[model samples]
Target chain A: MAMLTDLLVISAANRIIGLIRDVFVALDPDTAQAVEVLLYFLVMVLYAILCELLLNGQTLGKRIFKLRVVDASGLRLEPSQVIIRNLLRLVDGLPMFYLLGGITCLLNTRMQRLGDIAASTVVVRIPEVSHPDLDNVLGSKYNSLLEHRHLCARLRQRVTPEVAAIALEALTRRDRLDPVARLKVFAGLAAHFRELVDFPAAATESLGDEQYVRNVVEILYRAG
Target chain B: MLIDLPRFVNAERPHWQALEAILKRFENDPDLRLPIDEAQRFHYLYQRTGSALSRISTFASEPELKQYLEWLVSRAYSIIHGQAERRRFHPWRWFTVTLPTTFRRRIQAFQMSLALTVLGALFGVIALAIDPEAKSALMPFSHLTGRPSERVAQENADRGKRLEGRKTTFSASLMTHNTKVAIFTMGLGISYGLGTIVLLFYNGVILGAVAFDYVMDGQTIFLLGWLLPHGVIEIPAILLGGQAGFIIAHALIGWGDRRITRAQRIREAAPDIVTIIAGAGVFLIWAGIVEAFFSQYHEPVVPYGIKIAFGCVEFAGLIFFLWKGGANSEQNNSSKA
Candidate 1:
């Protein structure tokens, strides 16, 4: 993605240079060439700066990859910070090919390059988020656990958020699991929940391990 | 400790939405400054939302709600605690007030940069004086390998004609190359000052060796004419680069207060480092133009005395600028008082 960003920036710079040169056809050949080189350098330096600023801390490449440059302190990135970090590319590119920058990034705890350290910026990946479809997973099944309101309340209280999440995930992904693994997972979850809250023998005797787990999930997620 | 996840989310969703709306405004337009009442309301929403997130954090059901609240609280925390404000930039004030003031503030780093260069220059002079055979090794450039007298004669004979058609190209190359060197010098400060020191010293060595060789060959007038016009600005620009580098090194080393973290120190020094380097870059551009267009013309085409005088004037102007450029600004006055 970084390399792709570099290629896009270079291509854009070359196109701009060509357009400018065409407009100034009467210029001396050496002077024209000088302008091209100077413009190329300027564009190369400013490309990231402009893109990051205008696009909310993302270059074209970073945007494509859902990566962003943010303030390491968890604040909004300041313009001066942007300029300082980008300018430090001169040092990062030192000895050639960003070797120095790459080494510094590897050594640093936050994976920040020298430029990032100086500027107090960090590049982070933005994860894609969507609400889990609870209705689809926990259908309107006849939950025998809901019959004992007292035990259902107790079960919700005793179950930790982490444990609840694991149960929910297991139920949601049950189809993807093999039959033996699926049975084993439900057995484990039912045992854990059963220990947390004891339902009566009448509520337990008729329910299979899978159906028992499903009833618990529905009770935990849905209201009567 | 018990949480009714649906009821809790239902009660707090409006506050979370309000806070998100405010944050979206800040994010979309970083320079936006809210009115006092609006700002207070924003603060209220953040605190309220934060309180709600803490309550639901331990709840077992509704992981999606927990994640959403965590995201909101994190954004609010960043916005509320951020030290830097997005202000409009004024270039004239930056050059006159900010640049010189920053230079004055970080003068110690500049002094260290100067000291290292001088020490390196002294080393170069002694080494060359003792072993003239090391001239080729000391001066890496092919043009500088020959005797100074011969090079001066060749330059005089050309009378600036050598750069007639390609002056702009030469100038552009000089500007870009010198600017890169300056930036590289400053960037090396990340090495905790070691790399910066070595680079500055190496630069001084080359300068000293070349000057000594020219003076010894009885071509002092020609050398001065050739170098002074651009050297006056170019040398100081390089020094500014060194100065910025030393500043970074000092911050990393925590030379002063032990209480401040490395990140805080670097953050505080960032604006000044940027100011000095930008100033150096501007100076280099001017020096590049002068070196290609004016310094190359020697003897009959452009007299040595005029070139030397021009360099002196430039030196004086630069010193005056750095010493007292923004001394009378309103902000400076208020600070002084």
Candidate 2:
């Protein structure tokens, strides 16, 4: 994100300077030619200083990518830290194309550029999120196993939480699976449950693989 | 009666949704402020979501709810803990402490660059002495054609003067030019340091040949007077660039700790690499000022001895400061830092 903004700032400055130079060349060629390099350097320095100060730890590019500059402790980024990092950015930008900074970033576990290390700042990813609907997975209420509340309690004691969650997810996602896949998934889940609990043969005799899974979900979540 | 799964979800779903809502707002706007009630509720919901995740992961059949809560909790954690109101520090400390310390760490790389420049200069001088008529080949006259060097040499031969009133403008341009060169030298270390070496050697050869050219032309006094003032500062500035370049090269080649990846070691040394480059930049600017205004304009007006003496002083001061200025405490704090 930071790199993109830097490019924009540099190119914009160049265009503005180029226009002024054209005017100067027509008016005072010598003066314009002499100050060209100086003008560009000053603009570049000012660009770096102003962008960091005004943006509050985010460059135009950084904001676009949802990456923010923060202190190492995951706290607020300090202005000094920002300066240190940016100052070092010149070094990182050496030989063109941030090759030095890129190498450093790839090496470090934190993915910090040269500036990031000196300033004790980190670039963190701020992910976009939304509310997830629960109706599809939690809508069902009927449970044939409700008659065996005591048995459900025993099953809960025997089945660990991890095993129960897996069973529920498979059952919720049952309709999405192909018939062959559905049967295989249920068989594996049933075998896993059977290992955890020794249910009576009479309870299981008539139950298909999907029905057996449904009964397990009922016993775990619906039965008291 | 069967335990009502929907009823259980009904009780907890509002909390999860509320948490999600506040976190979503923060994600969109990091600086956004929530109402006092919402702020406290946000924290409360985060805690609830954490507990709910463990619970759902254990007993609940609603995997999606557990997943939702987990995502909300993590986002909340990033916001609540990361929204730090920034503090300020002394900027001077960065140059005084951090920069010098970092440069000091890579002293070996600087030395290597210095050696290359010096060797190149010696080679040029030797090559020129072996054949005085080699001036055309030795000097970069092809590049100098119509450039400032050609004009400056012509004027100096006539009136022993050049760049009289345009010193500031020229210095500014030279400063920019030198800085670019220095930075380029430091940055090219990634190419196995090959580019850096070639640049340093090429620059050294130019300086050496130029020195020999002035000697042969009987302009030795004028050349010394011209180059010393700025060369004292400028030469070291370029050398520092070479040092920084070599530092990058060192990192690339994996100078230490085979157990860790080469890139990791380079990251560890990134601070030093930048510090050296920055210090070099400062010197280059100073050198440019001396070159455009002081050195080039000093001849006839300023005695050659005075000019050379001034150059020597600047050079000696640089060496002293680089070697001894912050050595005492750096030795003690080196490992800790």
Q: Identify the candidate with maximal lDDT.
A: 1
Docking class of 1: medium
Q: For model 2, how does the per-residue alpha-carbon lDDT over B1-337 read when each residue is reduced to its tens digit?
A: 2234556668888888888888667655545777889888888998988876665555445445556666677667767775354224345665566666666777788888888888888888898789866656666667432334454566556453456546667888999988878877775665567878888887888789887766766777767777888987888888888887787677667666667755355545555776677788888888887887677654356678998999889989887777666666677785778
Q: Candidate 2: misplaced stretches above 4 Å?
A: A1-6, A14-36, A42-58, A67-125, A132-224, B1-102, B126-153, B157-166, B256-264, B301-303, B327-337
Off-target runs (Cα >4 Å) in candidate 1 are: A22-26, A146-166, A199-204, A215-224, B330-332, B335-337
Interface RMSD of 1: 2.8
| Clashes found in each candidate (C-alpha, N, C closer than 3 A) | 0, 5
Tens-digit per-residue lDDT, B219-330, candidate 1: 9998888898999999999999999999888888987656988777777788889899999999999999999999999888899999999999999999999999888884
Error of 1 at B319 (Å): 0.5
Candidate 2 chain A: worst 10 consecutive residues by lDDT?
A129-138
Among all windows of 10 consecutive residues in model 1 chain B, the one with the lowest summed lDDT is B56-65
Clashes, model 2: 5
lDDT of 1 at A203: 89
- TM-scores of the candidates in the order shown: 0.93, 0.60
Number of the top TM-score candidate: 1
lDDT of 1: 0.85
lDDT, residue B271, model 1: 80
